[model samples]
Target: MPLSAASRPGGAGLDFARVLMEVPHGRLSGTLLVTGDPGGRFHLENGVILEVTSPGSPGVETLLLRSGRVTETDWASAVRSGAAGWRVGAELVARELVGSAELQLICAMAALDGALAMGMGRIDRVALDPEPPATCFAAPEGIEPEWLSRESERRIRALGGQPVSPFRDRLSRTDAGTRLLDDGIAGERRDILQRANGRRSSRDIAFLLGRGLYAVTVEASRLLHEGLVDVAPPALGAADGPAPAPEYGRNPEPTGQPGRTEEASRLPRRRPGTSGITGVLPLRPVSGPWRPPTALTAEDRRFGSAQ
Candidate 1:
């Protein structure tokens, strides 16, 4: 069947962790589609994760190209062959481009990386498709969603120790005298820092760097906690422009008496059934104020009450 974006039944809440657990426990087989920042799909068979794909991370093909293991032409040829019924990984192995074990490792790593990225941000929406696209290749073994959830939890805890959640915040270089490169930063970390323009969010940096969002987010969080970077102020909305200067020398319309009495400043009279505490308390009818009893009744004394 063609891919269709279906909403959750009964308008259920979106919780990545809970979904992961439930899918595996129920031994369900389907593609769990998640939509949001770093949105992705988890392909599972009987609760075992067969594959994962996310916009927030590089795929196996990109990884191979970036690692210089294969040329673009070679990748294209392999893909064409795979689409023609030969498994891409098998084709590459047959062509002596990579070993069987190596291909398996790469596929597993890519799946895990994508899953990690998917777990990093809020899952805004989700759907399950009983039928997923048929592929020429199959994973040597499936990954347990339970394990993925545990690893995700560990990653979250590690990130929680930092000052910021990079996936959710934009970061920019700090003016601190300490330099990132001077501290032996090189390769990916250096590349990430160079792209930290205070305007791009971590997801943007990931796409720019052609790396996994989770990896970039974790590194950005570390850089922030180490004071090598700072969180950028939130961008203002179109309606958030500066307020017009007050009309000087013109008498402003009286919102109230010239000098509103202190009594007027007291909390707005609670709606008949609302509490005096504006938001801290629930909106319920206020009973009479508390008062001490003049004397405890015999019944109260029996219950060990004090007068």
Candidate 2:
């Protein structure tokens, strides 16, 4: 569904990375709902990403099932029991089926994976669902938005030299491919290669493997470069053409200006107390008297001297 201007609040031009930058810096507490192609909801607390859920990718439940950590019956039971309160994690923990730490780790991975998948595609609209202060189950503590953006950029850079497009390219193993034993391919890549049948797109392979699109694409790209596989452009009646190149997390192009870096020269300086928006909660200023003490006080010094 298309998001209206009122729902987006941050304006239509804001992409995923930009939205992420704005939320954390503004310390906004709510769910940032992204719609269209690679849609998802980013749950934030004090501007930190607690969890991210995307319809385009496999969620925690699917990941757990595909990993063989939980049986389908067990997952179904948990979901049925926890549906009223949305406490599947709590249910599993209470039943001792999965450890709290393991659950947290899995959930964190799922959220990051979903976010990464969303990052690879276009973000059509962004809406804020203002939620009250509350605790989250299996939520990562204090995950910075900038860190996510940087990680996304790094992943994109890693795929910089890839010849096959992640969106449109369909891959098939080369006829020279042999059994898995001698070729040295193992783990996720092996699994991905096994499923590549010239019919499925990278997104399909990701869903089949319960892996992230970015990961599958990167691996497939490597395989293509190695001549182990071949890529075909989108067939007729395919989904929309390849999305525009990512905008927000990419490195800024040089303007050819002297004595200035692209980032330093082009980006606008964020004004203090700007709120980062006209509605909802305003950004909390970093400057304050509560800054950490740099050194021991006179009393502590005197006490140490006496000792």
Q: Whose TM-score is greatest here?
A: 2
Q: lDDT (0-100) at residue 270 of candidate 2? A: 18
Model 1 agreement with the true structure over 258-289: per-residue lDDT tens digits: 22211111111111111111112111231212
lDDT of each: 0.53, 0.54
Best by lDDT: 2
Off by over 4 Å in 1: 1-19, 22-27, 36-38, 82-87, 135-138, 175-185, 238-307
Any residue pairs clashing in model 1, and if so which?
none
lDDT of 2 by residue, 1-307 (tens): 2334423423432444456667666888877787644557777788776666775555666556666777778877877884425657667777777886666666655665566545454445667778643333445344556655554444443433356555546677776544552477788768877766665556556656665566677677767766777875444433343222222123223346422321121112112212112222222333322221223123323322432
C-alpha TM-score for every candidate: 0.60, 0.66
Off by over 4 Å in 2: 1-16, 82-84, 132-142, 178-186, 237-307
What is residue 208's positional error in candidate 1, in angstroms? Answer: 3.4
